[model samples]
Target: MPRDQILTFFSKYIESELGMIYSESNDFQLQNRLEEIVKLHNFANIGELYQSAQKGITGSLRQLVLDVATNNETSFFRDPKYFRAFENLIEKQIKGDLFSDKELRIWSAASSTGQEALSVAILIKELKQKYASDLSFSILGTDISERALEKAREAKYFQLEVQRGLTTPQMLKYFTKNDKDMWVASSELTKHIQYQKMNLKDAFYPHEGFHFIFCRNVLIYQSVESKIKILSKLESSLVDGGFLILGVGESLIGLKQDYETIMLDNAVVYRKKQKILKVA
Candidate 1:
């Protein structure tokens, strides 16, 4: 088979599996990544790799492709405004007793390397110390990359990773340096956080709905239809009047009408719109 045909086949396959778009503009990127995979796996060429993929590449090869294709660019508290917004919302909820049983549930949908989830945990810890001593919360950190999840579970970061969006006080307070000089997340942050492997394109349901869901920096890679589907699922996974925090530039303007846009601090967030019942 020709090289163009192989690239086209793999591009479509990646979209069908991951819902990640690979247009002509990004063809070079896709081709480069595919070639890297070919070299990594010692395949003769892209065509040979494609042939192997077609012949039941269900295990390692499939996971390798997915891992290579995924963009796991994340940092601790990547968006300060959003974190401040989340903190304010939680504080308000706590004061108003909006929590049903003094317990909060949060989902970091594309958790990446667990920074976002751990950041939420750190905020919750602070809130518990200052306002509600008995407040308890659980954070679910999920991603599509097993490699990323492994690193997240380790909860260790190099100096540069810790320095990105983390202050000196926060780094000293929440992390301890190991012999290898890697900063590890404190127990207080990790105790309530759990990591899992999840694909946003698939249907997902949590055992219980979350008060807030952070599915950031991911929908941009998906098609508009895929984005709508993902947004619908994320909405369903939220409790009534729950919040959905997306990436800084992401908007739901033309996608769905089920959410009410609101601003907390300087960050824009969405709240699940309550349904009005009609009397027959």
Candidate 2:
């Protein structure tokens, strides 16, 4: 097949499967990535790899493509302002007696390698220690890449990863170094988290809505249509009055969703507005 044909095929396949756009403007980047995969697996060449994938990209091959295509660049407590905003939300909710008999549920919708979710776990632990000793909480960390999910489940990070957003005291308190010098998350932190594989392109929502959803740095890769669709689903996945924190540059300015705008702790977040019932 022609090079253009191959690029088009893989581009369409990736967007369909992962909701990530590989537009013509970035064809060179995508081609380079495909070539990297070709070299990594010794696939004769790009054409040969395409031929094999054309037969059917399933199982391990598909996973390898996805793992490479995804940008799993994440670190502990990424964007401190976001965590500060979340802490403010928790305090406000607690003041309103929101957790009287409820479990605080948080969903890290694109929890690459689990740092974001684990950060929330650590923050919540500290909050509980300060005021709400009986506070109950659970965190669901989901990512489309199984490889990333595996790393998240392992709950281990290198020294550099641990240092990215952690204070020395925080690290010493919550992580222990293994023989390999990897900082392993303490049971106290991991116990409240569950890692799962999920593709946001799919229509999925938990039966019990989450109080906070972190879909940060994810929608930027998606097409505008895909972004709107995912945002709509995210809105539905949040409990009324729940919070949604997108990446710092992401916004709902053009979207139809009516999530209330919230600004706190130098971060702008969105809150799912309470639904009103009309009289019959």
Cα misplacement distance, residue 110 of candidate 2 (Å): 0.6
Question: Considering summed lDDT, which 10 consecutive residues are worst modelled in model 1?
Answer: 93-102
How much is 273 displaced in model 2, in angstroms?
A: 1.0
> Per-residue alpha-carbon lDDT of model 2 for 41-108, expressed as tens digits?
78999999999998999988898899888889998888889999999878766666553436888999
Candidate maximizing lDDT: 2
Q: How many residue pairs clash in each candidate?
A: 0, 0
Writing each residue's lDDT as its tens digit, candidate 1 over 20-120 gives 98877788888899998999889999989989988866888888898888889999889899999998988877786565757789999999888999889
TM per model?
0.93, 0.94
User: Distance from true position, residue 242, model 1, in Å?
Assistant: 0.5
The positional error of residue 172 in candidate 1, measured at the CA in angstroms, is 1.1
* Worst window of 10 by summed lDDT in candidate 2: 92-101
Q: What does candidate 1 score in Cα RMSD to the true structure?
A: 2.2
Question: How well does candidate 1 score on lDDT at residue 68?
Answer: 84
